[model samples]
Target chain A: MKLRIYALAYLLFLYAPIILLPLFAFNDATIIAFPLAGFTTEWFSELTQNKALHEAVKNSLFIALMTAIFSTLLGICAARAGAMANFPGKRGIIGFVMLPLVLPEIIVAVSLLVILRQVLGVNLSNWTIIAAHVLICTPFCIAILNGAFQNLDPSMEEAALDLGESRWSAFRLVTLPLVMPGIISSMLIAFTISLDEFIIAFFLTGTNPTMPVYIWGLLRFPASLPVVMALGTLLVALSIILLTLAEILRRRGIKRAGGTDKGGFL
Target chain B: MGLLSAPFTYAILLLAVPLLAIVLFSFWTQDFMDVNTTFTMDNYREIAEKPIYFSLLQRSLYVSICVTIVTVVLAFPVAYFVSFKVHPSRKSLWLFLITIPFWTSYLIRVFLWKVILGYNGVINSGLINLGIIEEPLTFILYNVNAVIITLAHAFAPFAILPIFVALEKIDRSLLEASQDLGESKLMTFLRVTLPLSMPGLVAAVLIVFIPTIGDYVTPELMGGAGGKLIANMIQVQFLQLNNAPLGAAIAIVAMLSVTAISLLFVFLNRRWLRGRS
Candidate 1:
């Protein structure tokens, strides 16, 4: 009984800041103090009309889309190879590829800036941000897709191969259909991560900033607090929706692959 | 093996190359636009001689330790509740709810803590209005405490999930057997449950500790003047100071510190496990 109450409080503590976003976004006050200011939708309306925010959002969307596609493609190769092949040093190779998952974003951002901007003398642009995003997002994609591949019956692909089919044809015909839901789920997840990523984009982005960078700029001016709150509310809502969809698809992929429900990635 | 070539090549080019570049760059000196390729330890020496850099590193380690302890210790009970006490059918729903806040904009979440803890922020104003205090509380924001609180909150899910996974894997029959043998519930938990969950606890510690030291946002946002950390210093060296070599040196130092500490933690845990078993 005590544990139940503690869990309730713990959830409350975890959620209080997120709850404040929508509360203050609609509150009819510039200051975020809690005096029960009258509700207003002005902040949301303001966000719609902001041209710069729109531009940032567009840039972020493009970057996120590219990141999702490329990372999932890379992840498919890695995951497929991992599940099917017994290559030498495979464990070490996979660990090395997944190193970015735990490395500090600042360190990654700094090192990439040094190598790309300084050594290569390449102009900082959205492409650099996309590259960094793909590097980070690929590990997560591989993690998700590995589950999809693990749940599949390896014999199904071998059977297709034995029936006068090329390896590529067998994979395309037998394996791709099974992991399609997983592919979509991983893509959605990668898209969400790339969309919300701030540190790498902040470092590598050239002239145009991503949405999170734009929000960080807005945070500097006190007058834009409510608008920032409004933006936060929208982003939180979007992320929750995307992740819920991704998790659902992930579970569906597990079921489709004839795997038991083990409560896959959330 | 053939299929892994493309992604492996990309990973090597982007990730591995940059890491090696950092190690190489740390030894070189930069003067204005020109980076002398000649290797030197001047940057490392500068870091050692400078009081600001050393103090910031110390504070970062301290803050990270505090945040890890706060997050993991607080999260353990909540994880235990969901794993052992909650209905099996509802576990996914509970885990999902816990993870929703984690996926939201991390930048915004840190910023919101600044709002909630500021001088005229929610807590202060609410307290003032309720006559709980004559003046708004000023200590909650813009200090190390605020940084710890914001970080502990942000990384709560990371700590909880690993511990929850560990707890979920424990055999419930062991607990029943302990109780059947006349052990108290607390004793059963201490003897049978805690030892089994140490792996998850260690993972939680590393997950929280490693990233907490690298955090530049929370300190920059909520850490007022005195509360700045090593990442902020690393940022200054790269962006404001235009000393990429020195920045690379600091990054290397911070990374090594984290790696050493984490290794030591794991080593100690191994010993503890062996000793117990």
Candidate 2:
């Protein structure tokens, strides 16, 4: 009974700030204080009319979409290779790839910034940020897709090849379709990570900022706080939806492949 | 064969190249519009000579340790409950719910805490309305405590997941055997469960500690003047001071220390496990 209550309190502590996000977002007060000042949808409407915020959102979407596609593509190759091939230094290579998972984003950002600006003389742009995002997000994608690939039976591909299918055609038909759910899961997870990413985008972006960078800029303006809260509410909703979808797809992939569910990112 | 290794090659170039560049930059000096490629130890010297850098590094380490300890201690009960007390059918559901907050924007999460703990924010206003306090608490918002609280909250899910995974992997028969031996439930848990979950606990500690030490966002958002961390200093060096070399030096120093501490942790954990066995 005591442990149960402690767990409940812990959940509350984890969730209270998030609950506060939507609560005050809908509250009709500019000042983010107490005494509920009636419910309002003005903040949500304000989100639509802001031209700069719209541009920022567009940039973020473009970056996230591109990041998802690139990272998931890389992940598919890596995960497939990891599952099928036995190479010298394979574990070392995979570990190196996943190092960015725990490496400080600020460090990655700063290092990339120096290389792009100083050594390479490349202009900072959306492409640069996408590169950095892909670097970080690929590891997550590989992790998700690795499970999918590992669960697959190598005999299926072998049988397809033996039945007079070309290797490419066999992979396209057999392996690709089998791992489709994992691919989708990887894309969604990568998209979410890229979308919410701030530091790398902040450092590497040129003029156009991602949504989080824009939000960080808005934080300095005291009047903009309510709108940021409203934006936060929307982002929170979007993230929960996307992440849930990703987790569901990941679980379904495991089940479909007849694999026991080891733990996933969720 | 080449196709399979394409992504690995890309990873090496993208991840490793930038890291190598940082290492090179740390050893070189920056002259306006021209980087001196000649290697020098001045960057390291600057770091060694500067007392402020050393103090900030110490403070960052201290804060990170506090956050790690608090997060791990808080997470254990939740993980224990989910692992042991919860019904099997509902365990995944509970875990899914726990991770929902993790998917929320990290920046906004930290910012939300600012609003919740600010002088005129939620807690103070709610308390004032209830006539619980006449004056708002000023200390709750801008100190190291605020940084610790916000960070611990941020990292709770990270701590919980690993520990939960560890707890879930424990052999149930061990618990049964301990109980069969007439051990108390708590004693059985301490003997069979706690020691066995050390790997996950160590992983959780490292994950929370390393990231929190280098976290600039939380310190910038919730940590007022007094609560700045080493990452903030690194940020200033790169952005404001126009000293990439210095920033790279500081980053290298920070990374080396983190690596050293992590190694020490793993070594000590191994020793402890060996001693117990």
Candidate 3:
């Protein structure tokens, strides 16, 4: 019973700053402080008028979309192999690939920056950022899809194979259909991670910065703080909607498969 | 062979090669506008001599450790509540609520921490109005405390998942059996539940600690002048100082330290388990 109160307080501590983002965003004053002056959507209106912000948003969307597709595609291959195979060095390889999940983003960003620019002499662009985002996102996708594949009945795919279907065809026809929901959720979550990511974008973005980088640029000016808050409120809303959608899809997928629902990445 | 083809190539080229490049780069020195390919130890020597590097690394580890402990300790109860108390049918809902804030922009979250901790920020103003305190607290923002608070908050969800999974994996009958054997609830928890959850606790600690140490952004944004960590210095070395080799060396050092500490933690957990039974 006492733990219940502790849980609520823990959540409040976890949520306090986030709760503050919307407050100051709507508060009708430049100074973000106590005593609500009035309610206004002025800052949000300001968000629509900024040309650079619009461009940043466009850049972020493209990068995120590419990252989602590529990472999820890679994730399907990896997670499928993980669930289906018993190869030597399997655990080592999976752990190696998943290292990016825990590797410091700073390290990832800087190392990739060095390798792309210094070693490969590849110019920094949206593609560069996408490459980095994919590296990070693949691990997450694999983690999610791993659960999905594990919950699957491998015998269905086996039956397909025994009926003269090739291995690829068996997976394509049977296993793929079963895991489509996981694929969608994986893509959505990957899209969110890439879109919200900052440090990698900070280092890897070319002339056109991503939205987070643009927000970082805005931090230099004190006047634009409200605009940032408004922008943040929207980003938060968008992510929540995406995540909620993903979770629902994942749950529905589990139900459709007649499996008791386990937890998802949500 | 087919399954390993695409991702293995992608991971190797993208993840493996770049990490190798950093290590190779660290062996050389940087000359103005050019990277000298000649192998040298100057960067490591500089790291050894410079007090700031040590201090920053010390602070990064200290900050990372604090964030890990706080996040894991605080998260355990929430994880436990959801796993042990909540109805299984609603477990996903609770997990969803827990993870929603995590899905929000991490950059924005850290920036907001500045706002909440900044002078005339949320807490200060809220407190001043509530008559809880006369003066605003100056110590929270642009300092180590702020960094810890922000990182801990960001990593809370990460810490919770593993611990919750661990707690769920425990056999309920064991707890019942312990209680049946005349053990109090507290004794059963300490002897049975806590020991069983160590794997999750260790994973949570590493999950929180590794990235927090490498995180320079929070320290950069919320850490003010005095709050820079090792990652900040690594950033400074590569970007501001034009010394990629030095930055590479520091990163390599930081990475080694993390790996060593993580292994030490696993080792300690094993010994503790051995001692217990």
Candidate 4:
């Protein structure tokens, strides 16, 4: 009984606000309060009409899509290196890859802001957000793909080479096809990270705000709460769908690669 | 092959170059139009001189420690349920539920707390409706308590995931053996289960601690005035104060403090493990 209460409380604390977002988004009244003042879809409808919100959403999607492609491509290389290559400085390189995982986002954001703006004398733009996302997202890609690559048996590639195939041909025909699911998952995860990212985008994005930065700006206006909640609800649904799909692909890849039942980063 | 090399070079050029520049800038000093060639410890010194710097650093550390402790205390039971009590087929459902919070925008979740804990929001309204208090409580929203609550909520899943992993790794027979040896249920749990879960606890602590200390958002929103942390000070230095050097200095200092504390924890853990062994 004690354990049950504790578990319920913990889970409630974790999820109450998140669940409430969708509730308030559908609420008719602009003011978020108890009794909710009947349900309506106006806030969700309003999201489509707002020009700035639309542009921010477009910019966010564009950045996420591009970041996903670049990060996954880089992940393919880095994952190959981390998993298969027996090169010098491998441990050091692995640590370097994981450095951003521990370093504060504030520090990373500030550093990038200073270096890009001051040292390079470059203008801050959507490109800077892309650059920042790629830096941060690559590590996640490498982590996901590492699990994918590690599950792969290199002997198959070696066998292909022996069976009248070149190394590049074997890799393309055998290895790439084998880990495609992981690659897809990595792309999705990278995209989600880029989309949800705020601090870096807040600093780096130019006149065109990304979705989260736009939301932060909207937060200043109290009356926009319902719309913001509606937007948040949409983002939540999209992210969950992407992550669930990513997990499914990851599991399929692992099964095809003949790994044990469970081993992958969440 | 060309496709592979192209992306590899881009990562090196784009990611590696900017990060390396930051490290180099941290070492060098800037003045007027040009950065001075002379390297100095002046930036580091200023961090020591600013009284608010150390105070905020301490607050950040304290808040993270508090969050980690609260998360561990809160998460252990939920993790225990999913790992031990739930049937194997239902485990994924429970885990998915844990991850639902993470599916949303984090900022949205934090902002929701501002509403819940606000003067006229859910908690206060509920209390007022009950006639427990004649007026809404003003103390709950904009203080250290609010920051702690929001951060704890943010990090709860982090604490749960690792602990669940650790709990899942426990051998069922070990607990059986303890029970077979005539130990009480609580004794068996303490002796058999708790010791084995230490690794997960360590992972949970790090997951909660590291990010909480560096977290700037919750402190900015919920902390109002009383909950100001190191990240806020660093932000001030970087953006509003327009002092990159001092910001870098404070950041470096904050990083070192975290590193030192983490190392100390690892060392103490090692000793504890050794003693146990």
Task: Give the best candidate by DockQ.
Answer: 3
lDDT of 3 by residue, B136-197 (tens): 99999988999999999999999999999899899999999999999999999999999999
- Summarize candidate 4's per-residue lDDT along B119-198 as a digit string, tens digits: 87889999999999999998888998899989999888778888998999999999999899899999998888988999
Score every model by TM-score: 0.97, 0.96, 0.97, 0.91
Per-residue alpha-carbon lDDT of model 2 for B171-216, expressed as tens digits?
9999999999999999998889999999889989988888776789
Fold similarity of candidate 1's chain A to the true chain A, as a TM-score: 0.97
Clash counts per candidate, in order, are 0, 0, 0, 0
| Best-first order by TM-score | 3, 1, 2, 4
Clashing pairs in 3: none
Total backbone clashes of candidate 1, pairs 3 or more residues apart or in separate chains: 0
Give the alpha-carbon lDDT of every model: 0.90, 0.88, 0.88, 0.82
Candidate 3 chain B: worst 10 consecutive residues by lDDT? B1-10
Give me the displacement of residue B54 in model 2, in angstroms: 1.0
Cα deviation at A256, candidate 2, in Å, is: 0.8
- For residue A177, model 3's alpha carbon misses the true position, in angstroms, by 1.9
Cα lDDT tens digits for candidate 1, B90-125: 887788789878878989899989878988788888
User: Residue B184's C-alpha lDDT in candidate 1?
Assistant: 100
User: Native contact fraction of candidate 2?
Assistant: 0.59
On a 0 to 1 DockQ scale, where is model 1? 0.69
* lDDT of model 3 at position A161: 90
- Segments of candidate 1 deviating more than 4 angstroms: A264-266
Task: Name the regions of candidate 3 deviating beyond 4 angstroms.
Answer: A162-166
lDDT of 3 by residue, A138-188 (tens): 999988787677778878888999999998899889978888888898999
